[model samples]
Target: MVLILSAFLSSINQVFYAKWVQDIDPFVYSFLSFSITLLFFLSLTVLKSIKVKKSNIKLNNKITGMNSIVVLNIITAIIFICFYYANKYIEPAIVSAIEIGIGPIIALVLSLIIQKSNILKFDIYVCLGILIGTLILVWASLSGKSGIASDASFTYKGLLATFTAGIGMVLATIYSKKLSQAGWSTYEILAHRFYMLVPVTIVFVLNKKASYILDVFQSNWNWIILFTFLGLIIPLYLIQVGIKYCNPLFVSVTLTLGPVFTFVFQLLDPRVKWSWISLSGIGCLCVFVIIKMFIQNVGLNKEKPKGEKLKHA
Candidate 1:
């Protein structure tokens, strides 16, 4: 249920994110987005510290997952960079489909190899199914048939960024679970994960013209808050909660539904033209994800659940 709700909210988030990027520089948007999250969690941390001081309780400064935290922050910054560039050049629906769709398969393979477990033949078929669908969607966007010219350089950058982010997204999630295993609270993980991103983005934001940044803030401050909570803050926390209780593969499968929802919501925007090719690609992607879920369900019935392993991993 947490995963499903997270997927649903994330689907809506892609549309808003795409729209915002079209209006402002992706670098600025990315900085503002992370700033909102950082500030939210920072407030929480400060309040918690105050409470602990009032009670004279000793704060536990001995961090157990510094390595995982460092890795998670790096991957997260990469994901945000890719996310902004990809959404700017590629259709948001396609970006969401490929990023959310192909990621789990790769993560599943890596997990199996790391555990030295057999790769199910069914897994191969499912991976191929999702890949084919994702490819079709990419072709639709890049074929000069989706009302956007198929400029190689223009489209290639977005595709490259999206794939990079997809891989990073999976690795980030895995490391996040590792942190949870190390006993970091969800809010702490969320708050501290931006250690690298905030400082670096602050540099970029400052490099821009002050008047332009001020104008952007004045014009879109309301949207900044709205999308910050609706898109990043809430869904991120939910995803972390889901990650804490579910395996990465299961979480990825559930998130595949995000692109399906994005396809529908994306069409409601006038900026995006209706493309039969795009719809077909997303449809195929969703069908494959369903089949993969069914296969996983059957396997789970015969043994201890994957979530149990992830919780302990």
Candidate 2:
């Protein structure tokens, strides 16, 4: 039940994140959102701070304590900028689909290259499914009543941007995993991730020649707070928590549903027609995921050793 709610909220989060990225500097926003959320979470720590069970502390205090976070900050700033721009030029649903759709494939390839994973038959099938689904989605998008030329017009640019963002995100995930394996607590990582963004955002916001930080104070704070809470704090925490419990690749696969959920919400919003091609592609991808999960679980069950049977003995 918790997982179900988490997944549902995670989907809605992609929508709110799309909206939030519009007005906020992605770097600063990422920073501020985490900073704010950290404070909120930290406040809970004050009331009920459970001591993190101490594990072997391999964290390189000199090299990783502050320095590593600093590097991640810079990398995340760049990622957010790319994401913001991509969302600006393309529909959020489509962009989300393309970015997350390719995550498992890219992650698998990178894992193999980095010696973090072994190539498997099912991985290939998953990759093929993702590719086919993506192509079908693109084709459907092009065939819309809006016309093929219109769909194809920004397709390449939009896809490239989203794809690049996905790569960045994958790299970030790998790095985070490495850091976590080295003994960084989730809070500590989140703190470092957000803390680094502070300065980056300041520079970006200044360079934009937009209103200064003080300008934000003059605007309505309600919606801003709402967006920050719903879009950033809540969802980010959920994702971080979710990844803690499940395979990262599976998390990426679950996120693919973001586009489907977004499309459903949008249809109710503006009365858009669903295209058969896209619907079928989504169905195929989902069916493939379910089948894969069932097979993997069955394999796991088969691998378990049976206890001695007293009656037979």
Candidate 3:
């Protein structure tokens, strides 16, 4: 239930974010969003720590933990930039569909390599299905049969950006999972991430004149505030909480709804038109996700019997 809500919120947030980035530079946009979010989380963290006094919120001073958080923030920053640019160049629906669809596969491979985790044979088959679906999607987009309103030439660049963004998201998820397993609270982890991001964003914002930043805020105060809340704060909080309660792969899979939501939003917009080939591609991706979910459930059921027998023995 938490995962579902998180996925839904995240999906909606992406649509709004795609719209918000149209007038703002990606760097400037990210800086403002993260700055506000950082302050919000910082205040929350302080209040929570004060209430508990000597809470379990210990600092993870280990080199491995520190490295993970640092790398996670860097990847997050990169993803923000890539996704904003991709959204600018591509149709939001196509970008969301392809990017979100590809994330789980990347996460699975990264989990295997970094954690030496076992993979089910059925999962391998499902991955193949997803790959085929993704290929169909790419072909439909490249053929200019997609419903998205973008130039064919620029679509390729958008696709590349979305692909990189997906991989970066996967990496961030893996690192966040590691931090959760190592006894960090979601708030602590998120706070640290945004805190680290602040310095980098500050540098980016500083490169632009102060008046330009102020003028942007002045012109788009409502949008900026809404963007900060919806795109940065709420979705990120949900993700942190969802990841704390669920495996990263499961969380990523749940977010497969994001593209569907994006498609729905596109349909509501009078500017977009759906094509049969693109619809077929979307259908294929949905089928792939359904199969992946089934395989994961069956695998979990099989594991339950072994655990039961071990407990009885």
Give lDDT: candidate 1, residue 302.
30
Residue 9 displacement (Å), model 2: 2.3
Sort order, TM-score high to low: 1, 3, 2
The candidate, 1 or 3, that scores higher on TM-score is 1
Model 1 lDDT, residue 116, Cα: 55
The lDDT values for all models are 0.78, 0.58, 0.72
Error of 1 at 180 (Å): 0.6
Error of 3 at 221 (Å): 2.0
**Model 2 lDDT tens row, 59-148:** 344245555566666766666666666665455556666676777777777766775554456656876787677666656555552112
Comparing 1 and 3 on lDDT, the stronger one: 1
Superposed Cα deviation of residue 6, candidate 1 (Å)? 1.8
**Best candidate, lDDT-wise?**
1
Stretches of model 2 off by over 4 angstroms after superposition: 1-7, 16-35, 38-71, 139-155, 207-218, 268-274, 300-313
Task: At residue 35, give the lDDT of candidate 2.
Answer: 56
lDDT of 1 by residue, 1-313 (tens): 7777878888788887776676698778777778889989989978876775432221232255787889988998888888778887777888888888888777777777875554555666777788888889888777855523446788888889999999998898888888877666688789889988877777777878978877887899998888889888999999999899887776777788788888888876677888788888888888978887776666543333565442211
Models 1 onward score TM values of 0.88, 0.74, 0.85
Clash count for candidate 2 is: 0
Give one clash count per candidate, in the order shown: 0, 0, 0
Worst lDDT run of 10 residues, candidate 3, spans: 304-313
